[model samples]
Target: MTGIKMAAAVCVALFLIMPTIAIKNHDVTEELSDVPFISAADAAHMQEYVAFDTREKDAYQKEHVQDALSVPPAECSECLFDALDIYREMNILVYGADDAATADAVELLLKNGFERVWG
Candidate 1:
């Protein structure tokens, strides 16, 4: 009777709260996924570093961080290591049109053993 009703109520409350918790967790993950890389400000502060803008040469030449270099993403697979050799022991920050593209370039740089890689 009364005890059975109380138990049912508790179960219903738990079920309702569970969905809210799950939704909040999902929202947090979505927000984090959208920001998969570091900020430009962090890249700017590095003492010894290279900023590689993976955008097209035209877009890169139009406007880029001071001292940044233009290295299109398509060409990165072949040239990143060679370029890094010129700045050995310096941090490398890769950036592009958006986070996804930047993240892809960062992954390639890391795989190729470019230490201190960032994006």
Candidate 2:
């Protein structure tokens, strides 16, 4: 599967991310550019969370997780509270073009009072 597709599957599985993930037959675990998605059996759990595509605006317009809001790195600033305070206690899922970026975005969200954030 493609890297992004594999990542999406991971997103779904995490919420029961699927099994072993590989991109174009390459095991990308060590070289992954994005956060590693985990596993959870309850898909319903996602209902209590919000998902954000933390890439640039153009990138997010081109592609993003279904139902996820587009919150570019710059947009993730303190202004988030204007709309996210009501959901501060909710779980969050942040994905970016790469792993490091995703981690940073997740951390930012957490610091801003998001209780839980998953890859």
The most accurate candidate by lDDT is 2
- Shift of residue 49 alpha carbon in model 2, Å: 2.0
- Which lDDT tens digits does candidate 1 get at residues 40-108? 333334455566778888877776655567778777655566856776567776666755566677677
Model 2 agreement with the true structure over 1-119: per-residue lDDT tens digits: 45455445536633322233222324435434343343333323344566777789997787666667887878765666667677677667666775557667767776676767755
Q: Highest TM-score: give the candidate number.
A: 2
TM-score versus the correct structure, for each prediction: 0.62, 0.62
Off by over 4 Å in 2: 1-47
Off by over 4 Å in 1: 1-36, 77-80
Query: In candidate 1, how many clashes are counted?
Result: 0
